[model samples]
Target chain A: MTRLTFPPALHAEWIKIRTLRPQIGALAAVPLATVAFSALAGLGAGDDDILFSAFFGVNFGQIAAIAFGTTAVSAEFHTGALRLSLAAVPRRGSWFAAKLTAIGLPVLAVGLVTGLTALAAGAMTVGPQARDATPAEWVRGTAGCAVYLTLMALLAAGLTTVLRSGVGALSILVPFLLLVSFVLGDVNGNAADFLPDRAGQVVLHSSWDGTLGPWTGLAVSALWTAAAVAAGLWRVRVRDA
Target chain B: MTSIDVHDLTKEYGPRRAVDRITFRVPPGRVTGFLGPNGAGKSTTLRLLLGLDRPTSGTATLAGRPYVSLARPLRHVGALLDAQAAHSSRTGRDHLLVLAASNRIPVRRVDEVLEETGLTPAARRRVRTYSLGMRQRLGIAAALLGDPGVVLLDEPANGLDPEGIVWIRGLLRRLAAEGRTVLVSSHLMNETASFADHLVVLGRGRVLADTALRDFIDARVHPGVRIRTTDPAALENALTRQGHDAVRHPDGHWTVRHARVDDIGPLVSAAGVPLLELSAEEGTLEQAYLALTAVDAEFAARQHEEVRP
Candidate 1:
């Protein structure tokens, strides 16, 4: 048998995502919608921390990133191309890792840019309300948003792998993120802060006083991401392509 | 010898058995045609060989090693299972580029295969825009990218035009001539008749026949000698008296099977029969495949009836 030594699967996966129009469109929509929504919201609001307000749209924007990540794998299954991918790279572990890296990097980039742009634009619009917020707070918010988006993207990728269908994965993810989180927040009060979306949302705050601290919230979200990804990897490894 | 060895391969989907104790070897340096009717487990067998699907209780090795055991599998084996099994959004060139990268193949090799498969002009176009024939060509290009020692293609000529079919036939022939093991699965026996040197005939997830093309045809399809004589009655009577099975066709020609053309001339001459034409009718691969499948169909029907009662 010939020894097969292919390049890092990440490079192949990156090309796979980058060339697809839907993924690019989803990535672009994140920042554009974030800045636009934040600017419009900042215009009507009082002189507040416009940076935080500007990025309010990220609450919705991350869903697009999640959708993109989910579709990356699910679309292959939907089109029956997953078999070909397995044929190309038989190592399921490497293939899943590569897909994670490919999806995580772009969503992170878009999250950071959108978060920062929303902060900057909101601060300029809100005048004195945005004052007193330190550069450190802005940096943390931007960096945290990127990390949150990356984790969320991975979570979505994992769910999609297990479900093996874009529509099925999205049906579960959307309600959980949008509706279930809200209902659970009302029911459990501060306890709901541990939920992935709420926990990850802490980093976007310039002011303190969320149910969980920023770092702790990020950690909680990371745990969810890890657990979901592990489950997905396990399913992919054992199941037939 | 760079052959595919399958041992007790079995794959079950719930209670239904997609492949059952299927075992066959595909030797190198020849086109081993994997022939079966639809749903006879041809694709499933190929998937097992490539380790794309987990077998319930068996193993298939390529070139004496499990496919998953090979670190760089593309360098040893290339496969094109489905033409449309590609990311439609990527351009043809980029699709091959990514596969080439995965296999550590040189970027130039991508263009080489594109030219080889006559997909150079459409290299820049998105795969979604490609026609089925073009996609087939692209799939072939991807498979040949590494110039592996073994190639496996499943129904590669499904959507190809006549010209494309001819191109693929020549390509498979050339690859085998270069001593590469080529396993191609197709339901169209006629299409693979001249191209395949060996055959692995499958039926109901089992190896119905695994033998050389010539031997397969000779055994399953009875070879016959066609003699057109001025006195057809005399030729038929002579053949019948000699205990040879000879049938007279509506065209007033006597067709004698299980006999050689050389024997026919002497026998007719000895019987004092006037012979105007003596032609041999050689059996085709299609005839052999049909005969083989017909036997399987009858056996299956009988089994079904027995179980129902």
Candidate 2:
């Protein structure tokens, strides 16, 4: 038998990501929705905080990022795709690793582009109000946006793999990101700051009063993503396709 | 040489055993037909052999190693467990391309398999638009993508048309002739009868018979004598007197059970019965299969009755 290499498996997974329509839609919507909403948020800004307004689109754009990651992994659960995939690359860990790479890289790329776009759109719309932000802050926030979104997407991908359904992952994630991050977190005080979405969102803020700083907040979210990924890998290894 | 070896492989889901502890070997350069009724564990066994599902105990191996141990699995074993396993959004060609790319198989072989499977015209169309037959063809094309040495197909002819079925039959024969091992499972006895060299029949997750196709059929189907006598009444009376149960047919022919043509000829002549014509009818694979499964059906019926209120 020919030796199983990583390149071919990675290429095959990359093909799956680009071929499906929903995945493309989710990926495309990341920048569009993020920039669009940031522009709107910039227009309604009251000059209290400028940088946060510029990255405001991330609030809405992250849904698409998570959707992109979730849909990518969830497609395999349907149509006996996992069986075909595992049959080709018999080692479960290698296939999952390739799949995660396929998922993580694209979402990170799109997330970075969306962050910069949202930043530019926010600066243009909320003109002069955004002038208080330093270039270093802009760079940190932009890079942080990309990393945070990529982490969130990986988190969704991991959950979807465990559930083996795109809908199942979306159902749990969408409501948590929307309701918990926006609504419940407001009333829950310091405890809500550590939730995956809220902790990650600290990077988008220009000034913060939370116990966790921007990078630390991202680390918290990273921990959540790592746990989800570890659980997903364990499930794939033990469960039959 | 043995290409596929399954030893005491069993799989259980909760209280139900999907595959019982059973063993068989498929030699190279031949087609082994896995015959069973629906839910008889044929697909489950294939899944276990391919490592898609872990066995409860024992092992299934390819050449001397487990399937998972193969470096490039698709290069050694090609399996088509479900035709609908292809994502509907992807085109037929894309599906095979993904599989080919996974194993580092050249892209040219993808087109070749499409051409061979008569799927060149619909290769670019999304899989959702294709008919069941087209999907089946696509699955077979994927299985042949790597041009692997061992092919395991579960109900390969499930949705094919008559011509498609004939094409698959010829393709399987050609693959086996190329010294590749082919194990195809199907509930349709007549379909497998035309091409299978070996037969492994299963019932209720257990193997009922494992032998060569010819031997399996011969062992189960008893050859009977067909005779046409001038005096039907005298023939019956003489056969009764000679302790032979000659069953009369609606077409004026009599079938002599458990007796050969030679035995019938001498007995009829000695009994003074004029025999106009006599011939021997060979047993068919379908008859043999039905005879083997009739007991299974009866047992199922009794169990059903036992559960009724």
Q: Write the per-residue lDDT of candidate 2 for residues B27-50, one digit (tens) a residue.
A: 999999999989899999999998
lDDT string for model 1 (B1-309, tens) is 688899999999899898999888888899999999899999999888888899999889987889988766777889998888778888999998888777677899999999999989999999989999999999888889888999999998978999999998999999999999999999887898969999999999999999999999999777789888898778888989899999888988878988888888899999999987888888999999999999999999999999995
lDDT of 2 at A53: 84
Docking class of 2: medium
Error of 2 at A240 (Å): 0.9
Give the candidate number with the greatest TM-score: 1
* Model 2 alpha-carbon drift over 4 Å, by segment: A1-4, A185-189, B229-245, B259-279, B295-309
User: Least accurate stretch of 10 residues (summed lDDT) in model 2 chain B?
Assistant: B69-78
What's each prediction's TM-score? Answer: 0.94, 0.93
Root-mean-square deviation per candidate: 2.4, 2.9
Among residues 3 or more apart in sequence or in different chains, the pairs in candidate 1 whose N, CA or C atoms overlap within 3 Å are: A3-B72, A4-B71, A4-B72, A6-B102, A47-A129
